[model samples]
Target: MSSTFETVAGIMSETADIPRETITPESHAIEDLGIDSLAFLDIAFAVDKAFGIKLPLEQWTQDVNEGKVPAEEYFVVKNLVSRIDALVAAKGA
Candidate 1:
């Protein structure tokens, strides 16, 4: 697995109390792992601290709330991994 996926899985493991083995690229944060909105905020904060990348939590949430971004897009593990990897690459660049 990519470091981005590992880091995200680790955070979800702790925040959602789900086993690391159970977390997969296709896992849905809300449906599969039972991560609520508040837990997601905590996960976002943890990701920022762990990777030194800032996720646009407020903006993303607003977009989702306003129906601009689908809620499922935000809660899918693979999608989050892709976004984090992009951010990390951007930071390194």
Candidate 2:
């Protein structure tokens, strides 16, 4: 797993009460892990703190609301890992 995946899995484990062992790239935050909206917010906060990068929360929500991206895609572990990798690379660059 990538470091981004590890970080996200750790955050999910803590915030969503899901076991790290069960967290895979295909895991769905809500369907597989039972993460509710409130828990998702907490996970987002934790991710921001851990990575020292601010997630584009407003943009993500707006995109979903505007039908740009499926709302469920936001909670996919692989998608989150990819996003985090992009953010980290952009920050470094």
Candidate 3:
């Protein structure tokens, strides 16, 4: 995995208190990680800080409340991973 992926996963694991192993690119933040609103906020905050992306809190809340978890996770994690990858690339570039 790239350092960006490792860093994202590591922060996610620490913030959500989920095992890093369980937080694959396919792991659903709500279903697989079992994260609630606060937990999701925590993850978003951590991700923002870790990747230098200023994710808006209000937008995040709206997304979570509307069940639009960044990637709309259901059975796969590819969408979420792609979002993260885009964020990481933007930050790095």
Instruction: Give model 3's TM-score versus the native structure.
Output: 0.67
Q: Estimate each model's TM-score.
A: 0.89, 0.88, 0.67
Write the residue-wise lDDT of candidate 3 on 1-93 in tens digits: 666667767877898788888877767667777877787678778878777776555765577678787436322345544556676678788
Better of 1 and 3 by TM-score: 1
lDDT of 1: 0.88
- Candidate 2 accuracy as TM-score: 0.88
Q: What is the C-alpha lDDT of each candidate?
A: 0.88, 0.87, 0.67
Where does candidate 1 clash, by residue pair?
none
Query: Taking the tens digit of each residue's C-alpha lDDT, what string does model 1 give over 1-93?
Result: 888899899998997688999999999888888888898888989999998999987887899889999977877899988988888899999
* lDDT-best of 2 and 3: 2
The alpha-carbon deviation from the true structure for residue 75 of candidate 1, after best TM-score superposition, in angstroms, is 1.4
Question: Candidate 2: deviation at residue 19, Å?
Answer: 1.6
Off by over 4 Å in 1: none
The sequence of per-residue lDDT tens digits that candidate 2 reaches over residues 1-93 is: 788898899899978888889999999888888988788889989999888888887788799889999866787899988988889889999
Clashing pairs in 3: 26-77
